[model samples]
Target: MPAHIGRPVIRLAAHRVTTDALLDHIAATCRDADDPTKPHPRLGLWKRLIRNTGVEQRYWTRPLQEATAPSSVGHRAGVAFGDALDLAESAARDALDVAGLDPGDVDAIVTSHTTSWTVPGMDVHLIERLGLRPTVTRIGLSTLACVGGAQSLVHALWHTLARPGARVLVVVAETLSTIYHESETTPQSMMYRALFGDSAGAAVVTGLTDETSADLPTGFVALDPLELVMPNSRDRYWGTIDDEGLHFDSTRKAAAAATDAVPYITDWLGKRRPEWAIVHPGGPRIIDDVVTSIGLAEKAGRYSHASLAENGNLGGTAVLDVLARTHDDPPAPGSPGALIAFGPGFTAAGVYGAWI
Candidate 1:
């Protein structure tokens, strides 16, 4: 179970859109479709949610108007897949550089993405783009949502543990803006529009051959007793695709589910309290709930909050963004830290680690 994860590299979409622009677009789109004189009843609610998201701006593959414009499902899927590949390729290359390795040095490539569907997936494309060895093992994971980034690290850790001296490249990328539909004006749709952003993150995990190689950048040696919890509460959040577009269903109960699962997580942690709590920024509410439930210090989740306030939620790649920031400003050496992320499974994935 000895492995070291390198510093994560993040690639954001080219266009940065503000929450105010998004609200204006939504209002204009709704007004054009309905009565122009009277304001939509839910408009105020949508504005409040967007303002309260704690996200001042978010990056997207395209401008706000183009990204949220009415479009055929097929067209949107094609565009999103292309954008995902572009971002993933950039992030993977930078990660390999950070690890002081070339594409050929990677023994395996693990990827997590849920915004687009394609036959060989983004993994194969990365293998080709990065010039990874033909024999490199590839694993593609989908539908894990925000938890996918942390889960990818778990997968990489196992790969290194099972294959000695192995070096695995893990990538988590999402183009959530492409899934936005102008036709769906529900609160969930508005929330998704306001909160979701496009970004990609990558990391390199190398098996610890011996104690000497423990001088890894970022103090990312794997911690023992990694844990993944799934409460079988999938109904709390999900997405469906239809002729119109992708629709997301996320209930207020999602936050409650996370809060309710805290005791079980604490029991698993037992007596060890991490000095740094790296919780996913699902939103402002989820962060507050997790911090309060787990009794983390007031500023323990600053990295997660910073990611949310700066980038919104990058879906599966959100946690990794925070991780990258944490590595840049790591905790004191020998201090313990925990990584936590929640997603569509209504599941929480956590791993405890120590700074080098």
Candidate 2:
């Protein structure tokens, strides 16, 4: 059975931060008061790198002034988990409402959140808070990073295909602000501060119904999902832990991770150009590389670029935000398109589909 995805909904954190504000905050917090001669050696480099991220603004779970303050990992985890849950609930409710579905209608739930570590994760919390059936199946993803949104939809599609008329709720939430601890001073760590945002995205996926039951608003009918992890790329992007909190780290080679996956993606796409494309807003290079390699027009990546500019990366929620924008300015009905996202494993996840 084909899986039909409804329009996605995204909920951003309370604090809206602009690039200028972010740079200023970094400067104020990372100064060397005692050793004025040093003056934080990396400040100039960090500023230059941040400006190149193509992120004009972003949102955070906490205020800029407090987020950069020194705090323990335990305290960061508690606040991060709480904030992620709040955003996820809002996004899920709005998604269900958009699909004209009640919580009871969901047969399964798929959730992805990597910014915090929680024993009973967002999936279980949502099952109770959203009033979903106790017997509803659940899948939780904790470390897929930017790939979580597309990967969640892929899992939901599998569930719908397995249980033909079943409805699956897909949610991805990230409170990346929790990782903005002042102790992280590396170039890679600083880049993340400028590139990531806190947001939650949700969508409903179900098996395609007969004409009589076609009242559902299917934004797209999903094709089989594709996944790939590049060889020897484990060090390209990964997570780290310390007294402060969780931090995202990457090597210089991370810049080419997206380009490296292009051939595989192109092959999986049957070496043909899709009518529309929903590339992840990992950054400008990731978006531009994929669009150009796949022979898509520069305008085809507008949604991805806009998402990066308006909300930073949104981590796992990046692709969902791009998908929402696609729905807003839809392509010709029945046009073919592709949705793709990249993550920490230097992995790529994608789904080909046609507008409905």
Against the true structure, whose TM-score is highest?
2
Clash number for each model:
0, 0
Put down candidate 2 lDDT per residue, 27-135, tens digits, no spaces.
8778776786455777899999999999999999998988878888999999999999999999999999998889998999999999999999899999989999999
The lDDT leader among the candidates is 2
- For the record, the alpha-carbon RMSD of candidate 1 to the native fold, in angstroms, is 1.7
Candidate 2 has which clashing residue pairs, if any? none
For model 1, residues 104-195, the per-residue Cα lDDT tens digits are 88999999998877888888999999999999998888878788888888888888878988999999899999768877777777787788
Residue 292 error, candidate 1, Å: 3.3
